[model samples]
Target: MSQFDRQSFSLTGKVALITGGASGLGQNYAVALSLYGADVFVVSRTQKGWAETRQRVEENGQRIGFLEQDITAPDCAAAIVQHVIDHFGHLDILVNNAGMQLRNDVLDYQDADWRRVIDLNLNALYYLSHEAAMVMAAQGHGKIINIGSMQSYRAGKNIFPYTASKHAVWGLTKAYADALAPDNIQVNGIAPGYISTDMTRSLQEDPVRGPEIKAHIPSGDWGVPEQLMGPVVFLASQAADYVTGVMLPVDGGYLLR
Candidate 1:
């Protein structure tokens, strides 16, 4: 192969499972991976909105599957993993991107809310990664990309549980990387800054807070979900064979300023 062919980051013949793949960042990750030639399986609670994502992936001539899964359930991870294995016969990449955020101060936060946030953001990721790692270890190669957040390191107002869970995600990424690196499995994180997704649509529409956020970001523009595709595909491809346990900021330099 020539240098150009050798350096291509195509995921041809790989299988990827993305949680929360019906919308937002997860949808973008699924599409990007499929476009690069991977067969993608998208898992989410609702299948109502995935037509666009499915069409896009199929248009790329890649195999696509969707699973309606409430990942908050304790057994959800293992089931999803088994389903993928049964359908695709093997797994090569896992994207833990299913999460939700609610605005509530520490004092007013409810215990149930805390548990819900942690369960989906942290616990579900643990279960899914644990199951996926077993498959990867046996196969001797895989990539686990955990979706972290800017709050993984920094904090904002009124969202204590989300901040805490995101911090835990950072620690989990490193722990998994350390444990799986010897098995030829690379575990990493992508901490995105304020991206333009439905989740952040309300904030983006706010005239007051939106401008304030835009001013702080060096790029002066909120990143789109598509902007995240390149980094994710790189991390999942051969280009990142030696890169693991690092939190890559696809934030348009927001972390710097």
Candidate 2:
């Protein structure tokens, strides 16, 4: 703690596996990790939109790998961890970023629709983390980063399941961090608020809600992917070896206002 070690923040020679990594914030996470010297592997439901992911990583002089499979698929937890180990010889980081949100009236929401959100957002994360934890436990070190949201702390108008799932995400992050601390694995989360992405286009473009959102944030604007790059790299590197069970908010002071 007395001396600064920039190398501790480097992810050189690490292997990272990211779920839903083909596009959006997930893609950004992959790119950022790779730029920090990790060989990134992406997993998602389809092979579409991977060209850009490959171009970005390779352009930065880092190798990239891909696997096409629904993260919610049965046994995906074990398969994905094994797939990464097989491809890179060992796994050092796992990013649980695959998730969905549905804006529906809670009173009229169907059970199937609710399950769809929970299955993908919460259950898949749990499964993947469990498998990755075991793999990391054996290796004596690893990093697991979960993507939570401002909703992980507060509920929205119609995203009932997303709110529930993200709150659970925060809980699971703590639980896993405590459970895996003995194995030298740090489990943490990033709770983003009003990030400018395709997923939040509707909300951002909403004439009525958009301004209200911008006005509410202390920064007075939506956050960009690049804004999250530093925290992501820090959490995944040796710099965060003693940091765990914590939810780091990347919000533009939205929670404060």
Candidate 3:
């Protein structure tokens, strides 16, 4: 028998909850966990476009479920967490991947816009985490994976709110990790860099900025949603029980520049 203990990375009996999982990185994360043997439940603002996620998970022989809710709405945290428990029997992992980037120059940035980004990216994420932590604490083990951004480290122009929220995400990872250590609850984050998603399609199509962004990354190309699969699975599995408070980058070495 192999001594690698590959089972440590398997989530065969786990149940994971992902936010904004109907599309983008969240969608891929949900699918990744399912493929790795975890039943997944997704929460999104809409029910549209969920067919692919459902089909993919079922095809992989894993169960999949979802809920339509705005994460920022009052009392949503407890409701979603309860929904996961009701459907999956228990929640082993929670992925806070629902976020938005409303870009505008400093002088042109609206107060409303700033609040909008923070509500979904930071405030909502924290509340959901709070609820999830309680369940995990009671169970004596769990994982919370927050999705941060390159802005978590280097603040780029035109996305001030997004940058600030991401920085706070890293801090929350450390804070929650420290507090939840006694309960065996691991809280961590993944910071993606220059991923090629619909949101970034415009940037990729830009003649000047496209090449400029690629030059800054050591990997020499934009990353994809699938690139984050392994890192997320590792963090959510038994393999990372001893690991917490880290923001692992799925970036193509974008921070090296």
Candidate 4:
């Protein structure tokens, strides 16, 4: 095959499972993967949002399914992995993208809130990825993409838990990659910086803070969800088969400035 044909980023025969895929970045990852030819399974707690995501995926003429899962539950990881295998026959890509952010000063933060944030953002990912890695190990080749954040590197006021979770995510990515690379299962992360999602719309609309944030981004604009498509597709494709444990930042150079 020619280089172009051999290295095409098409996911024609792949089955992808994206956690928290009912909306936002997870939804974007689902759509982008389906558009690139992968059958997608989305896991989320909201049936309403999952239905919407399913509709969009179906409109693209790709197979799409969903598992209503409360990722915070202890058994949620095993159940989700089982659901994907039962429905899709095999799993080739796993995207751990579900997370939550709570903004409270370290001194004022509630213990419950901190536990909730860490449970969802860090613990759940660990459990889910552990289950998925077993499936990937059996298959001998698979991709595990963790969704990290700019907070992985810098501190943000009133968001201690989020920062801590992201930092842990980075470490998890490296550790998983080291353990799994020998088996040909690649683990990596994508750290998105200030993307313009509904979650961040309030920040964008804030007259006092919006412009200040934009000014720091060398791109002079917030990144759109679609801008993340390429990076995600690349990470999930054969092109990145030899790449693992690296955190690719899709932050529009916000990290630099």
Best by lDDT: 3
lDDT of each: 0.90, 0.92, 0.92, 0.90
Error of 3 at 37 (Å): 0.6
- The window of 10 residues in a row where model 3 has the poorest summed lDDT is 1-10
In model 3, which residue pairs have backbone atoms overlapping below 3 Å?
none
Residues 1-257 of candidate 4: C-alpha lDDT, one tens digit per residue: 13556447999989999988879888999999988899999888777587778888888789988887789987878889899999989999999999999987678899999999999999999998999999999988999999999998998779989999999999999999999998899899999988897889999999989999999999889999999888899999988888999999998899897
- Tens digit of per-residue lDDT, candidate 2, span 1-257: 24559788888899999999879889899999999899999998998779999999998789999999998888878988888889999999999999998888868887888899999999999999999989899989999999999999997768888999999999999999999999999999999888998778998999999999999999889999889888999999988888999999999999996
The CA lDDT at 155 in model 4 is 87
Looking at model 2, the pairs that clash are none
Q: Candidate 3 residues 115-168, lDDT tens each?
A: 999999999999999999999999999999999999999877899999999999
Error of 4 at 102 (Å): 0.8
1 or 2, which is superior by lDDT?
2
lDDT of 3 at 111: 98
